[model samples]
Target chain A: MNQRAAILSLITPAYLWLALTILLPLSAMLYYSFLSDVPIGNREVSWTTENYRTFFEKAFYSELMLRSFKLGAEVTSICLLLGFPCALALAKSIRGRTKEALFLLIILPFWSNALVRIFSWTMVLRGNGILEYSINWLLPGTGPLDLMFTYPAILLGLVHSYLPYMILTCYISIDAIDNQLLEAARSLGAGKLTILFRLIVPLALPGIVAGSFLIFIPVIGSFMEPRLLGGRNGTFIGTIIEDQFTAVFNWPLGAALSFIMMGLVLLILFGFSPLVRRLK
Target chain B: MANVSVLNLSKNFGTTTALDRVSFQFEDGKFFALLGPSGSGKTTLLRMIAGFESPDQGSIHIGGKVVDHIPVEKRDIGMVFQNYALFPNMNVQANVGFGLRVRGISGSEMKRLVAEALELVRLSGFDNRQPDQLSGGQRQRVALARAIVTKPRVLLLDEPLSALDRTLRLEMEIELKRIQRDVGITTIFVTHDQEEALTMSDQIGILNEGQLVQHGSPVDIYENPQSVFVARFLGEANLLRGQADGKNVKLEIGGTVKTLSKPAYPQVICSIRPEKISIQKEQEVHRSNGNRVAGRVNEHIFNGTSLTYLVQCGNLVVKVFVQNLSGEVIPPNSSVHLFFRPEDTLVFPDA
Candidate 1:
């Protein structure tokens, strides 16, 4: 075969799979979103903008969507705050087998099934669970220490689930930076704080931005953790979307809500991309 | 600009010694080059001076203050890294002005000084250009400008020009020397390139195997290297193993070669630089004052400026370079005498 035919033959299978799996479902969802009702079992289904109009008209759906986005922003902030220093330590201070071991431990959560991991957090964070039990055992009459199904518990779970993504991206970026740059800064009479503010943060901005988006995008769409760990308080945009499909059986409304959520995520990502490019 | 000195400085990397009781003084406003082969601890010494590494047992003094416990930032030194570690996100102006800005000098004053430094390195209008936009040589200039903009007491360059091509290296070398002279900041440059050290430094300190083997002006070190390592490392040397007499070594190549220094040992190593040894068809009466070795030319290498003859004598091949002024290329297998003045021969212990 000639070059063009050979290239087409090699790429056709993957492209076909993507079209069948992702593109087809997305198109179906867009169509389903505009219908007045389900087209099934001889029910009269008519085209209408009612499903989308309900979204703009109702405060509940818009509130849940905003709440879901707020959760993403909070979790991503905590992850960056905690994980950046950990990554810097791994990249700059630790070395040899020790660094390898710590790095493996950080990403260990990613190797396991995410659902299993979410289930496991309930064992630790639930009322009278390991943390509460351990605390009461240490300090006799400190009470039940009820922390499960709270906002903080949900935040903690999300951060725990995604901290590794932040760390890995940051470690790669920090590791690529030449140690000489830091030394050069010091030799030029820059204190440690100045070096961090002036030299290190700007250089690692791209990594921080990438890691933030990776963690934020998934956390926004996540339903499993909110259901298993958060209980009633986890009823955010994601859980509401799940309700539209399974509980209410309103696939059209779910599709409209999903599209709106996707638009907000895209808007946020575009806002941060210019800053990333500028730093680079 | 102030004098810097280290006394009995030493550094060890676990099982291996990187620098051992090394000590030297760099005078104010003097350009010093620490010359050595790779892994000779030249860069290690330079880092210690820059306060990047603390010597296990030594005291460093800058100007007149002991700065043994001082951190690199507090020590007020400037370093140019081998790779020219300019801030990648920062433009040339920001990089140069970093030292001054961190010192709390801001606004137009900082801008003026940075501009002055850029002009000094001959990078006047490159202030807005990021480090990525510059070529290898231009980046090198930015690095130099950044280093000296703070009027650092001492400028430490760690093989800053090794990344450039030959022509660029030479150009940067001349440019660096001119900048160093103009600033009059005490400067110490570390390099494994001997020609660089020879041409740019007021004083050259040679290091070998974690030890300071010799330190002197370039002329003194080049003409009178005290050890086998220094003699060979500073420039090429044809070493002949021999037994020492009062002022000469009885060569292993079946001849007596004259020496400049009296050897304390019975056996010695005699080193003579290639260019110092002149090749002649036969020894003339006036040339009898110098030591002589007879050999057949194994091969002749010709360039427009110089000619090199690989002469085989006894069991060894010795290289000799002569200026191409005569415009006559010597043929291979021709018998010739290798002549050198007795004072040009260097004697060292046979270890």
Candidate 2:
């Protein structure tokens, strides 16, 4: 028919699916967050702000939220530090079939199940496990080096799960950079570190920021890795929210906590939007 | 500013030789051009001089100092890439000041130097504009400013003007020459365009198949080309293979062409430039110092300023250029006499 009709028809299906799947569920959660109790199973519920009030009134929820943010920051920073060099090597130094093979290996983790990967880490990290046996084999009778059920174990697992995102994004950015620019910088008397910090890193900042967003947002809300790798030490805001919905059946509190976490994330993203704009 | 010299520099990429024992001296305060076709190893030679590519068989000396072991960063050279290669993240000022900043020159000194460089390239008010925002010519100016801000010992340019449009390229040719003269840096650039090398360089070195075929001033190389390849490459040349005796070449087309210089070998090729041959409708005057050939005009290709007439003489077609004066053209199929001086007929030994 007309151009407007044509455009609407093209976009209608995808938007319709998103509205039904995401927008409707989110609206239901918002309504549940204001209720005093669950609105099902013959429980008399009234609309109230008590569930949200409990989150502010208690220090437990804020502390767990801060701890989750800390964990996200640590994992994201570690991923950037490790992944950027690997990406630089893959994009700049390595070539041809080797680079392609390395790239395949980087994303190979995604082919297997995430739960299986976390469980496999537990087998290597537990007391007197593969890691301990290898260490003691190197230095005999060095005692049981147990890292299981610790915060480090959870950090390690999350980093392992998310590092590929950082590398792939950074590779795209670094690869797009012209080699002539590097040579020009060197001819202008820029040494290795200067070229890296000034030319290469700044040019690749968009990728670094994108990778952080990809890893950080999901990491703060991650529940499985911590639960499997970290015993009691893995109790984050994610675990508390999981307990609220699945164990305690406090749907209202869980909805309120999820909304609060989302608000904080939006604030953080909004604060750094200028940096992203500058990259563009 | 210092003279740069490469002594027998050679480079091989796998099995193919990119540069083969190519050696030349680029005099200080002069503009030198490495002219060649694609894959002729001119770019490879420039890179060797710039310390980007190392030679397999020789050493490079800049200002009489052997810099084979010196790294590119410490070479103290300035290079402008073909695509400008300006840092997209920084503005013009930052890009120009990067070299100085890396050398630990900051504050007012760095700013003043960067400003002077931008002014030299006529990009004074463009300090805050990013590279992508600038036009092709403007980005080129920024690249030039960035290259020379630190007052490098030698300047290397890799086809710096090939990215610009034709009119812009012509303008930049003069602009680049003036900037080089003003800075007085020993500058060397690689180009495949013969006109660019002829118009811009103080000395031109022609490369063929990774070897230095001929090198001299523009006029020397154009007037007295030592080889057939050099004679054809610099400009349009009408090559006629024939038997030579003393100063006359008996053409295969049943004519004898006289030359001022005798052929070194019995068999030689006579090279005559298109512009050197004059066309006459009536053959009446013989100056006794020139060679003449009778031909019929086959075709006339006309431009605004000049006309190229493809004249067919027997079994050969000879090209002759005439100035487009009086708005007249010798019609095709007209019998004409092509006249050129004996000295204009360059004789080269055919191998």
Candidate 3:
């Protein structure tokens, strides 16, 4: 085959899969979002912009969307702050098979079922659970901690689920940094903190950014973790969208909300794309 | 200015010894080269002095104060790495100002000092260029500028010129010495290149097999290497084994060559530099300064300004370098006589 034919053959499968799974669904959603009702059986359907109008008119929906975005930002921030150090330690301090093993442990959570992992947190975090029991055992008479089924419970679960993405990104980036650069920094009279703040943080920003997006995209669309761990406080935009699709049968409203969330994600990516390209 | 000294330093990496009981002192305001082959512990010793590694058994003193206990950041030394590790994220100006900034010397004064350093390395206009944008030689200059901007007490260079091309290396060698002289900081350089060490350093320390074979002025070490390793490592040396008797030695190649040094042992080996040996046609008879051996020319290497003749004697091929001032070139397979002075021969007791 010619080069053009060869290149097309290589890319056709991926593009075909994406078009089937994404483009068709998105186009159908957009069309359904503009309709007044579902065209089931032989029922007459009418075109309307009421589904999008309902989103702007409802204060509850807007508040939920904002809350979901805020949650995403908070979890992403915590993951970055915590995972960056772990990655630095893994990439710089440890070496050989030990490094490999520790890295494997960090990414081990991905291999198992994510829902199972989220559910496991309840065993450790519930009132009179392992965490509370351990503290009470140490103190001899401490009361129940009442840890699970709260906002913090949801935050913890989200961070645990997504921490590896941050760490893996940062590890690949930090590991690529030359040891000579660090040695040169120290030789020039820069302290450990100075080397970290001035050299490492600035150099590893690309990883931090890429990891943030990876967590942010999934965390914003999440309903399973919040539903299982968040209890009453888990009523974010994702849950509301789930309610529209499964409980309310408001397919048009659900389609509109999904499109809006996707629009927000695209805006964010566009806003930061130049910075990422420059860093590269 | 500070004179750095290491006393009885040794380091081991598991089963392999990187540096073995090495002791040396760098005098104030001098350029010293730690010359060795790969895995000869030259880089290890440099790292120990730079505080990247501590010795397993010994103390390091900088300006009469023990610095082995001190950390690298507090050691007040500058290092130029082999790859010229300039920060790729920053421009030349920021890179040179990093030491000053970390030390809390900012503002216009920092700018002035950074500019002066860039000027010192002749990189004044390259302040805005990042490391990736600069050429290899330019990046090296930026690294040098960054190293010396803080006026560090001592400078350590780990094969600083090895990354450059031959012509660039020669150019940088002259530039390095000029900047070193201008700054006059106590500098210790490391390299496996013999000619670079000889050309760039005032003093040379030769290392081999994790041991300090010899250390002295470049001319002293070159003219008076004390071991077979040192003699062979420092440039090209022709080794001739013989039985020593008083001022004359019986060459293995069937002749008694006169020597300037007397040996007490019966078996001795003499090192003769190729440049010290002269080649002449065997038919032409003339008095030389010392010993002469008859041989046939095996090959002649024309090196533009000089010619190297590989002459075959009894069981040995002796190398002779004759200056190419003569218009006529000697042909191969011709009989020739090799003359070398007794004072030029360095004798070692063969063990």
Candidate 4:
């Protein structure tokens, strides 16, 4: 009985910490989502469904939600398409210290803050940035091109930011594939393309799916890239939520938008559950 | 069926020579076992034949056509790997039908051929079972069935039964021999197990240090091994280190022992099989042969049907196998006399 009591005492601190830090905040957010904004003095209290009702009633909010999902999906698809081949090359073609160096290069961007990376992209895509300058220099006849505050710039930033995640995940998966299976396929009259498609790709599906989700979830609520590179027309749901809290001083509405984002993430998680189970 | 000829085959990886100027001919419809220890270039030779590997400085001819430049898919050969190499996602039927499908065979003909191949391996109704669902022996049979389903002219097997248990290995060996006989395809089997090679191969080629030491029929290899490596590798043999002079040889053990038969070389190492040495009581002996040796029993090991006695004469220890007939037992530390006919001994050049 004394040992059991001691063991329980030992486990109580971590359990309490998790409850206070994670579970408590999530439950508070859930409760705050139901509260309505007070009319005056930028305050909100009491229970009402007006915040969710307003979001559902407004076409702008719905469009923002759709645009967020579209961007996330596009970023995930592009990352998967580009990252898988890069990872395969890294895992199979490179060797020794060269392979290690390539892996480090893929992961090097993740060490810096995402805001700084997005700011760098903004500097490059601006009207008189290096890209426009280089284009003007190379073409000579063409004038400076305006690339800032564009969808492509935001998409480019998002893809560049999350590509490392996809590549690393894919590398782990491709590296785990048995070389014997490829040799076996080759010996069994399978050509190089057949071996890659049938043996290498199918075995690396789990990694690809995992990397897709890792990049998609974060890109869905991305704020930095859209704010810096997208400018006025590049506003995302995360930026709107940030404006409600910091500029508008509507904590309840901000919490409500955050809850909606969490719900969207949950929907993605639910949609991917069956795929993950099937892969396993 | 086609004959495979490897001429001056040499493969070098960096500084290590995997196969050095190896050349051999596998006759049509002949079951040849490339018997050797590990790292003896047996599997390399098999892979070169399968076209999975390209020899550094040689040409491979199959059916009088140079196939060194041909890819593995165009080689038109079947291969069974050591691990069975069955695709985990595919069933036995799909695996067996893969070659046919690759060759554009479909419909009832493919199904019938796959069925026939499965039936040849005695696995008729196991079509839907995946490789993971089958036992080790079943998987091996599936590999064999897959290899033969295409009716390839040459079949390459790389230690097909090495992963199986002893009983399963024995059963598969018999099955393999029966299948080879039935199909009548030129087959090359690679294995490190000497007993397996001796039991199943019509011809065994012994390889050592990337070179073919000896190639002959099983009887020829077992009865008369040409080199010291072959004699030591095939089975247990008593190596009598001696200097040959005319019809008499001087042994390191005792005085010169006269040979009833002469060797081709003046100095040679005589190899005598353990079973060739016969032990008898000194009082029961009627006649003495020139090849007979006097020794005392140092140790005796009972091996179910026979008793193996280690006889020590001076510094030489020779093993002799005696059948345990009439419920006779040979005790260790006993005085015994061993004898062997001169014709039973084989002499090779001393290395």
- In DockQ terms, which candidate is top? 1
lDDT of 2 by residue, B1-351 (tens): 999989998899999999888889999999999999999999998888788889899999999999998999999999999999999889999999999999999999999999899999998889889888999999999999999999999999999999999999999999999999999999998999999999999999999999999999999999989888999999999988889865688988767888868877898888999999998885444444578888899999989899999999888899998998778888899888888988899888888
Best-to-worst ranking by DockQ: 1, 2, 3, 4
Q: Output the number of the lDDT-best candidate.
A: 2
Candidate 4 docking category?
A: medium
Each candidate's DockQ score against the native complex?
Answer: 0.90, 0.86, 0.86, 0.54
The true-versus-predicted C-alpha distance at residue A142 of model 1, in Å, is: 2.5
Candidate with better DockQ, 1 vs 3: 1
Candidate 3, CAPRI quality class derived from DockQ: high
Native contacts retained, all candidates in order? 0.96, 0.96, 0.90, 0.43
Q: Per-residue lDDT tens digits of candidate 3, residues A8-119?
A: 9999999999999999988999999998888788877899999888889999888888899999999999999999999999989998999889988987998999888988
**lDDT tens string, model 4, B193-255?**
999999999899998888888999999999888787898899989988788877777776765
Tell me the TM-score for chain B of model 3: 0.97
Clashing pairs in 4: none
Candidate 1 reaches a DockQ of: 0.90
On TM-score, the stronger of 1 and 2 is: 2
Tell me the interface RMSD of every candidate, in Å.
0.7, 0.6, 0.7, 1.7
Q: List, residue by residue over A126-193, the lDDT tens digit for candidate 4.
A: 88898888888888868766779988888999999999989989999899877656666666677878
Global fold similarity of model 3 (TM-score): 0.96
lDDT of 3: 0.91
